[model samples]
Target: MTLEGWIVIGVIFLCLVFLVGTTISIDLVLFAGLAVVFILGIIPAEQALSGFSNEGMLTVAALYIVAAGLKETGAIHYIVKRVMGNARTVKKAQLRIMSPVMVMSAFLNNTPIVASFIPALERWSRISNIPVSKILIPLSYAAILGGTCTLIGTSTNLIINGLMIEEASIRSLGIFEPALVGIPCAIAGFIYLFIFGDKLLPVRGSSMDTFQDPREYTIEMIVAEGNTLSGKTIEDAGLRNLPGLFLIEIQRNERAIPAPGPYEKLREDDRLIFTGIVDSIIDLQQISGLKPATNQVFKLNAPRNERMMIEAVVSRSNPLTGRTIKEGNFRDRYDAVVLAVSRSGERIDQKIGDITLKSGDVLLLEAHPNFVQKYRNSSDFFLVSSIEDSSPVTYDKAWIAGLSLIAMVVLAATGILSMLQAAIVAGFLLLVTKSFQYSSALESVDWRVLIAIASALGLGSALQYTGAAEYLAVNLLEFAGDNPTMALASTYLATWLLTEMITNNAAAVLVFPIALSLSQSLGLNFIPFAMIMIVAASSSFSTPIGYQTNLMVYGPGGYRFTDFIKIGLPLNLIVATIAVSLVPYFWNF
Candidate 1:
């Protein structure tokens, strides 16, 4: 390898280190690495930036807008409620969730499919007495498997198809070409889930279970010394019907008022004790004059009202992981006050000040609304989400959004419009019909995912431009000399491992050139290799980091990292076997 190739390799290794070893955002990491390579003259500026203009990347972004329209119009809720009706048992529930998801993901993008299903399935899990953990991972894996079954199922598929058209001068893949291998893998994957999911997946409680917590906490909130509530009754102060929280007692002038009634008057320095889920207790922090009993909260520079609520999930790589909330000076560092903390559906006791933070600990915070937008891409949190409901559904436009989606699918499937054209048109129709505002649609797009895909494409270009992919391909072929079956298996396994380590689209882009080079060197058809890349890249099941959908469900399901390993690893092997066995027979070596 030349100096440029070695430099590229070093950059790729750093990306892996920063990604797996830290809580940093993948998009930032990729872009930084891509930028470094660009500065080094490994690839020209146009090549480095070409991925931003790639048809496949744009399609993914447009589809996100369309999915947002569907979600913001209540169309997604209507369809899920109708299809996932009354599945009482876990087995039956999995079947219901997986069946429709697979069918939808075959045509629609899987990211939004899994995102829309999460909240609905959580509610379903509550009513049906089924654990969400058992079903959420399977839901993600099912969508991934389904995405392999069609040309437009995932951006990765389209990306690979585009590369084939460009590099090999091959005809664009027919819409169903992948299904020859994808269908068998999907079937095998579904059966593996049905048989082993219950046994392998954890039985952790869903977020709904948090409401049933019987533990009471003596949460103290001091009515600030100069508060308006000092002269108002409990009802007058809007203390009634505080969901899941009860004002059981109050202390004023060092005297306790037990079972305070709605008509009870309040006074300054009154310490309030409420018992409820941490989610609700955190809501109390939003009240302007009602400050946490801990004096530490008042030390923040921002007033309570100026501060908004954000939920930050701590990752292992967070620098504050081992420190207590007070010890860490969390508020001073992030300009956010920790209002409440939860771990695996259980609330940390009222002395949250003393509790140590750990990976996966969710902190309900009081900060500026932009706090979420600011730290959302930071490495300190595994996931940063706003507590506010900014995008409520416009129910009046539900039917319009639904009809638009159906039309987009029909038009694209019938070849009246290309997939990209259909997606763009559907997104425009969504904006025109008022399903969502232009700002809302733009916000709905997960820009990080797009940036990551685009940056990864640039890296892939570097690999090809440097002759690195061809060099790697020649060596990969040495192991499978004179054996097409071995070459196919090796390529599939390589793609699967790459997918496990990085985003699927990036994996497909980085590996396509090598797969093509290997097949050409061996005097074999490239169709089988291309089909294998589709199946292998899409079948990312061993780790949460392997796919976007899996990470989306991670916190809600209360799942540990190992939960994915136990369940997804087996399913990964099963799907890989099915793909390797079938791709050759269908595509012919």
Candidate 2:
């Protein structure tokens, strides 16, 4: 091997060491490696910065906006509500979550699907009395397994396809081409999780379960007319088991039912009273069919979607302390309407308008985002703070967002437009429909992931340009002793090991040139090798660092590092075996 080839190999080895041993961000680490290669003059400037203009990376960026649109419009939340029905056991809950998520991930991006489900599953765990640790891993793994089924499912697949187009000069893969092997692997994975998930997964409690807040506020919410919750029972409506909240009573047509049963059905305009901590109250506020009982929420100056939830404590020196909320005209004075009140860790049962203000009373208010900044230092309240992720959802535009996504998928699958073009069109549709603000679309893109992918692509280009990949491929073929099956297995093993150590997309990019070189040396078709790369690159189940989704669930699930090795290692072997055996059969060597 030449001096430049050896240098490239050494730089990549150091990159793996840092990625595995340190706490540095993946993007920064990979970018540093790319910079080193560029500085050494191993590759030209165009090759070094080529990844930023790659179609796959830009498609991933555009897809983030599309996912943001779905989230802002509450479309994903609506689907989760309908599919996550009652589950009596851990296995049933896993089933309920994994089935839809797997199908959804086959077409949509995997990261957003896991992101949307994490909080929902956390709440569901509290309600169902199931430890969150058992459900979160399955949520992430399901998305990963499903992403292997389609071209647009995960960024790794898209990156590989892009490399094929630009480097191998081959046609882009069909949308459903990977499904030939991916479906079998997904089915096998589902079966494994269903049968062994309960015994293999841990039972640790989540952060929400261990923490107890003393302050409880009694809040009243009404079932909107012609809403989904009107005819459903309390249990069916998902109101029976809020972790920190209790359904105290129901008021319908001047009649009160105390301690409503789980089987009790709700009617239109029925006012339900609940006493809970602030966290659970925030969850309740986001439910689509429920509205605050007080009409003041609707009378606020700012639009509902632009408002935020704020907690403020009343001071003794405040002028309105001696008067009831209605008598003092609180909304007119503060430009915020009080939704719930808690005093000395006790629930205030009086109606919101009838509750008399008291010193040190903590009020939950619905107001504009500027409310906190405007009164942070004022004597009107002791402290003012806005809750994170408390902005109201725009449920009215959900259909528009859903249809835009469907149109993008149809256009791409039908070959009417390239994946990048389709994603951009979908994002534009979302912006013009006002489903979410443009600022939100920009915020939704994970810039770090994009940077990591682009930098990794540059490193791959360095390997190919310096002849390092071909040298490595020659050694790999020598190890396989001229056997194509063994060569395929060797490539899959190397890619899988790399994925478990680094980011999946980075692993795929760094290994791609070598696989391409291996295919060329063997005088065989590259299709099978490409298929194996997709499967191997995505099979990142043995560790949290290997995949973004795995790391996402780590803290929430309260998982140890070995927790993944214990349960995920076996699944990784299962997927690897299925991919190696099926790829040659489907695509031929």
Candidate number with greatest TM-score: 2
lDDT of model 1 at position 295: 70
Model 2's C-alpha root-mean-square deviation from the true structure amounts to 4.3
Candidate 1: worst 10 consecutive residues by lDDT?
Answer: 387-396
Model 1, residue pairs in steric clash: 308-367
Candidate 1 local lDDT, 1-589, one digit each (tens) = 7889778878987886776567676678889999999998888999899878876667767877887777667677667657765555678778888888888889886765675667556644554457899889889989998999999898788889999899889889999888888888888888888877788888897545656654333356889777667988887665655656778789887678988999898888888877665545644553546777767655767543334566788998888899988888887888877766667755454466787998988776766677888888899998998854323232567888888888887777676887679888988998886667676677767687678777876776776677665456456546776689999888887777767655577678877877787788889999888998898888778766567677667666877656777788888788878888888888888
TM-score, every prediction: 0.60, 0.83
lDDT by residue for model 2 (31-107), tens? 99989999989889998998788766677678778877877788867776677777858998899999998998898
Local distance difference test values of all predictions, in order: 0.75, 0.82
Point to the candidate with the largest lDDT: 2
Q: Stretches of candidate 2 above 4 Å error?
A: 1-58, 88-90, 104-137, 147-180, 196-212, 442-470, 494-534, 543-568, 582-589
